[model samples]
Target: MLLVIGPGAVGTVLAGYLSAAGRSVRLLCPESALPALSAADEIVIDRVTGGPPLRAPKPLLTTTVNPERVTQIFICVKQPDLESVCDLIPPALPPSVPLVSMLNAPSAVHRLRERFPQHTALPASVLFNAQLLEPFRARVTTVPRIQLPFEHRQVVESFAGTGIRPVRAFGEASAWGKLLLNLSNAIAAVTHSTFRDILSNPLLRASYADLLDEAIRVLRAARIPFRAPLPVSLSAYQMMMRHAGALPWWLARWKWRLAEGAYPSMVSDIAHGRPTEADALNGEIVRVAARAGVDAPLNAKMVTLVEQVGAQRPPRYLSPAELRSALGHHLQT
Candidate 1:
């Protein structure tokens, strides 16, 4: 049995996939989302990655956690919700049930390990793009994959033949690598663009290239083991970044089939006036650079921009040019 906390996109993605794979799953969500969730008879697993949407019939949905029957737990909420959700976990959770954190940042699982010293806490980097279309619907825009801390067959095999595979190539390294790639998450939120737009637009592409260049330089200076975040290598992405503003004729595109609802988590957060993980995603890069006696002003800039935008009642908006200008002389090559 699996108890997935937070019925957001990622959480719903996990439930839908696991439930399809014949695993018993329960979703724990906030009370506010319950009404809309209850309206839907089943969780909708919509795919933009070349497939028809599938329905995963009712798994138990609750506002509270029932740990007694839960044989496994997946923490799918963002960093801000971590503490409150941690309090909901049964104090006597058996050591066998791993508290697997599928949060965006690698630091989340580190905090989980600190919170429950005796319990087994693991970080699993979510290597997929999913957007929450509704309270009970999640759209996967990419083929979903997970990077487990190690080859935990019990967890890996559960998703087998279910479209979500646990590829154990780089593990922790891939988690950090994913963080570096996610520096663009804030760009989507601040610019009011779809996650696809960030990479599709030449200006947005160049802006993110500037940010990624800054992060990579610092990570190398700190001697962190940089590896592939997605299935492709980091070097491959960096090469793409090099041709950031190139047209279709100048380069080969991945040709991602994105849905209209395909937006980043931060984009969704700002739209709904909820808090985002900008601090965790971009802020993590800033902290790492600071500890290494370097300044990650670009990443620091994103953290502040996301905060400023999200703090607005209507959510502050910026165009790609305005956003790039806001980054000021830092992005001027």
Candidate 2:
């Protein structure tokens, strides 16, 4: 049996879809969420790319994880919630059951390894975003996919026909590479712009470029490998961020395709008065830059901005120009 922890957007979508694919699955949600999810008895995945909505059979929803029956565990939670959530599960879970960390934080697997010292906590990068429009419905703008370490190949059989592809790669490198794109999530959250707005608008793209470049520079200085999340090379993806304005629409059409009413997950958290994962995503760059004896002020500033917004409800959203200014002198006036 597959035990998917959390009934947040990612958890519900994955557990629901896997169950739809005829896999044995269960959803471990917070105590407060149990009632609503239990009442729904299923989740609806509305695909922005078009087609009928996917109705995922409700997997067994519960507040507690029965380690005895769980064959594998997929942890789908924000970075700030990691330790607290892990504390809810029994430490006696079988050592053979791999703990898949499908988190935006690049270092989540390392953190998971620390917490579950005896278990194999494999790192996975969620290559798609699913937004929870309501209690039991998630919207997928992009085709849902996940990137896993080569070591995760053993569990690939569990994903068979689940509509979620498990692409194998060097986990650490892929996580960092994905972080480069995720930096924009904080940008969208702070500016109150849709993910599409960040890429489509020149000023927003420039601000995003500034953040990406800063993180990229820090990684290069530290000699950290930046393997592409997909088959494309890091240089190619960077080019898309840095010079997207000069390129034709076709050159960047894929970006638009995947972003439908898409704001970063942090946007929702901020809107609803919850913590964001700015620390795990942008904060990783700041920590690495410190270790490497480099400056990552832009990423650091973003971490502050995201935290502030989440703390103060009804945030006064920053305009693109203001955000670019906050980032520093990287843009023209």
Candidate 3:
């Protein structure tokens, strides 16, 4: 049996896919998530790129974990929820079950491993774009694929017919690659902009490009392997960064299609009055850079912006220009 924790877009959508693949799955969520979840035994899976909608039905639902019955576990909660969930997770899983995490940052797996030393923890980079339209309804706003830690053929084959594709990776390279792309997550949240808007705007694009570049520098200085999981290569990515404000036509067009119907997770967190993962995403870059004796002023500035905005009772609003000015001051300092 497959066990999924959390009821966010990723977890909710994953449970539907596993059920569609003929796997016995149980989704464990909090009491607040039950009303909408129990409304129906099936979830609507809409394919935005190009496909008909399908229903994944009858996934077992529960609020508690049954360790013995669970064969595998997938952790799909946001980073801010990690600490609170950590204590409740370790005791519920047997040592033999492989724990797959779809968190944004690679360092999250290390924390999970420390908490659940008896189990095998693997970091899976989520490449799909999904949005929650309603309490129980979620849809794939873009393509769906996941980069797993290693080439486990059986694991890869299990998702063969399903729409969600799985790719095998090595040495945590995929996680770092995904992290580079996700540097914009906080930017999207902070500016209250859509994904396309974030990339299309010169200021937002330039800010994100610099943040990604800083992360790459830190990783290189730390002697960590960095790879681009996207179709682009390392040199090509660096070249693209150079012309950050003026993006290639093809890339910009491709991004809009995927981003049109989606919003960043942190944005959703802001909307629902939940804590955002600013610290885990951009903050992770700052932490890693400090350890490598490098200063990432751009990312450090973003972390502060997110914290300030997130603390406001009514989410603090900041224009892109204001954000750029804030970043500029840090760069000058």
Candidate 4:
């Protein structure tokens, strides 16, 4: 049995897919909100690519649980709530029950590994983007994809039949690869635009490239082997940034198609006046760079701007000129 904790976008989408695929799934949500979703399926996934939508059968929702019944558990809560959620789960769970973390921040993996040493823990990175639009309804802007960086290949293989294809990562290198892609999430959230829009804007594109370049430098300094896959190579991306204005229309469209959709989780949070995972995404880069004695002014400034935006302060939109001014001499070539 698969246990999906937290009924947010990530958890609901996973539950809907797995349950629709004939897997027994249970949703564990907070008690206060349980009654509101008692009769609901708890998950509705609308595939953006015109694929058939998936709706989970009536979910088994409960606040408390006997973890022994859960053969596998997916932690889907936000980074800030991870520790509290983990603490709520009964300690009776068997030592063998694998706990997979589908979070954007890589630091959560390390924290969970340390806190739950007795249980088999697998640190996973989710590749898909989804949004919870309404009660039990999840708009899946991208297909469900996950990359698991763990030593147990069989554990990942076990998920093959469940539609959640798990890519096996040989080592921590895969973790860094996932983190590299996450750079765009914070960028999209701050700009309040789609991936297409974010990439289309030359200035925004450069800012994103600066963030990724700094991230790569930090990873390299930490002795982590992280590299982007073919066609999407880090070097190629940087080169594209240099000639973004010169790229042919068709070619640029092709590239956007390959890139993931604008991050819906961030969009939903921003629209609803909730705090975003900026600290987990770009802020994490700033924190790591500080420890490595590396400079990441672009990422730092972006983080500051995002935090300010999330605070509901004035100047909601930063114009290109404003962004240039904020970036200062860095924009001067």
lDDT of 4 by residue, 1-333 (tens): 788888898888888878777878888898877776775644677876566677668567767667668888888988888888778767788888887878777787788778888987776777667777665788776546677754676457556676666765645566667777667666666667676655667776666667777778777776667644224666877778657553522353453232344454775566667777778877877787788787667777877877776677432756645665676655324
Candidate 2 has what TM-score? Answer: 0.93
lDDT of 4 at 192: 74
lDDT of 1 by residue, 1-333 (tens): 888898888998988888877788888988888788888888788886665787787678887767578777899998999999888877777777888888988889888888889887877888778888787787887667787755677666667787787778465677778788788889999998876577668777777878888888888878887665543556667667657444321232254344544667888889889989999988988888988888888889989999999889898798998888878656535
Answer with 2 or 4, whichever has the higher lDDT: 2
The local distance difference test score of model 1 is 0.79
**Candidate lDDT values, in order:** 0.79, 0.80, 0.77, 0.70
Instruction: Give the clashing pairs for model 1.
Output: none
Candidate 3 is scored at a TM of 0.92
Q: Which rank order by lDDT, best down to worst? A: 2, 1, 3, 4
Q: What are the runs in model 4 whose C-alpha is more than 4 Å off?
A: 39-42, 150-154, 229-231, 244-261, 313-315, 329-333
Model 1 stretches with alpha carbons more than 4 Å out: 244-261, 331-333
Model 2 agreement with the true structure over 77-140: per-residue lDDT tens digits: 9898898878876877889899988888768888888888999988778877788877778988
Candidate 3 per-residue C-alpha lDDT over 1-333 given as tens digits, one digit per residue, 9 for 90 to 100: 888888888987888788888878899888887887888757777777666776888587788778779887788988877776676664857788877888888888999889888888888888887887775578887678878764555455656777687777765877888888888888888888877767667787777777877888888988788676766776676667567554633474475347463667788877667888888878888888889898888888888888888788788867888887888777633
Candidate 2 has an lDDT of 0.80
Selected candidate, larger TM-score, 3 vs 4: 3
What lDDT is reached at residue 262 by model 4?
A: 41
